[model samples]
Target: MTSVPTVPFHDGQSIPQLGYGVWRVEDDVAADVVAQAIRAGYHHIDTAAIYGNEEGVGRAVAAAGVPREELFITTKVWNSAHGYDEALAALEESLGKLGTDYVDLWLIHWAKPTQGRYVDTWKALIEAQRQGKVRSIGVSNFPAEQLEEIIEATGVVPVIHQVETHPYWQQRELREVEERHGILHESWSPLGQGGELLEDPEITAIAEAHGATPAQVVIAWHLAKGFVVIPKSVTSERIVSNLAAADVELTEDEVARIDALDREDGRIGPDPATIEF
Candidate 1:
């Protein structure tokens, strides 16, 4: 099995750089699929309340044969749960469903700037951490300003920021902001969510050169750029192959070639700045 590298968090903990994400996976099959991922050498699993698969993920974890301490589990509070109390309650509910006493990491699914309560939610996460219910806490889909707001309000920087990132939407500016604050950048759509990214001429050419699949090349690109990436798949072969991306080595120039694929209109997800939900 290929060894996945770990990224250090500002909180003194570390996370596997590569993880298995359950985004659109239905609850019915998530357990089996996640089990396959674990059997293929994935130590980190990312789930969220809105994904409706935490229970299945929990079941898989219980049956994985891998000890709880060896696997890194992450879940998030949804947008509906935006206030301080609601966020804490949300974490507790997630814990109950995950069948774990504490999650390795918990996050606010979105800033939901319209509600204007992420700061309070961040405080709630701080309280949860202090209570020993969570080992690390962070946010997803947060912009530079909101990241600053939460940190300013609580004096605790997020250890990681999960967002939509790929070769096309590289998030250069926001990544710079996160880098300045010692926050790790995590890519939610590292393979572009099964879109044209895998079919791009540049990606295919690079994949051929490395004798790898397009998805592997893309995952390798994310790893080379130092962004924590979670690529989701229900197929067992793809799950194993994606993890094999750890073996695909890319030169600095190749990484730059992928970087040049970034464009002004490359964003496929909602803009975090104006997203209400």
Candidate 2:
């Protein structure tokens, strides 16, 4: 299997470009699904306490027999656990559930500005990284203003910023801000949360040109743009097909054609700024 290139973090670490996201996957089925993803060549697995499938992921990780160092594991501290001590405790709990001593990447889940404690939680993450409890630290769903606030308050730029990104909602301006800070951008809904991007005429045309699936074309677009994408799927065939995207190369013009699909107002998820928690 071809390996996807890794993007460096602010802390001088690297993360695989293509990963497996276990979001919305039920606990009962998460282990088998994750095992399939691993068998399909996914080395990076993204999960969180809020997902409620950490134990299953742990089982799969152990069962896969892939050495711990060979896999990149990431999890987040949920919004309800936003204070310093609470965040620390939540990390311990997550570690327990995932059957790991330290996570490769730990994130602040959400800005949770309404809670007014993300700064405190970020401080805890910094300490956790220093203690080697986490190899890297970052934030998710952080807007530019909130991200700046975190940097100014903690004097630590996030290693990466995970956000809802797809062709329709490319987040170009926010990505520019992240680039200014030398932070990698990781896309959560890399496929538009199961929307029609995979079935769009433009995507289909590109896929037909490459003799690949529309999903492969979409994943190729993300890879070409240098964004880390964690696409989720429980189906064995889809998992294999998604990983096979690493081999599908898109020409610059083809990428440009896909970029034209971006819309100024095409977000498929809730705005992080307005989310209550």
Which predicted model would earn the best lDDT?
1
Per-model TM-score on C-alpha atoms:
0.99, 0.98
lDDT of 2: 0.92
Using TM-score as the measure, the top candidate is 1
Cα deviation at 260, candidate 1, in Å, is 0.4
Stretches of candidate 2 above 4 Å error? none
90: Cα error in model 2, Å: 0.3
- Tell me the tens digit of each residue's lDDT in model 1 across 47-135: 99999999999999999999999999999999898898999899989999999999999999888888898899999999999999999
Error of 2 at 146 (Å): 0.5
Candidates in order have lDDT scores of 0.94, 0.92
**Runs off by more than 4 Å, candidate 1:** none
On residues 1-277, what C-alpha lDDT tens digit does candidate 2 reach at each position?
A: 8677777887878899999999999987999999999987899999999999999999999999899998999999999999999999999999999999999999999997777898999999999999999999999999888999999998999999999999999999999899999989999888885558888899999999999998999999999999999999989999889888989999999999999999988798889888984
- lDDT of model number 1: 0.94
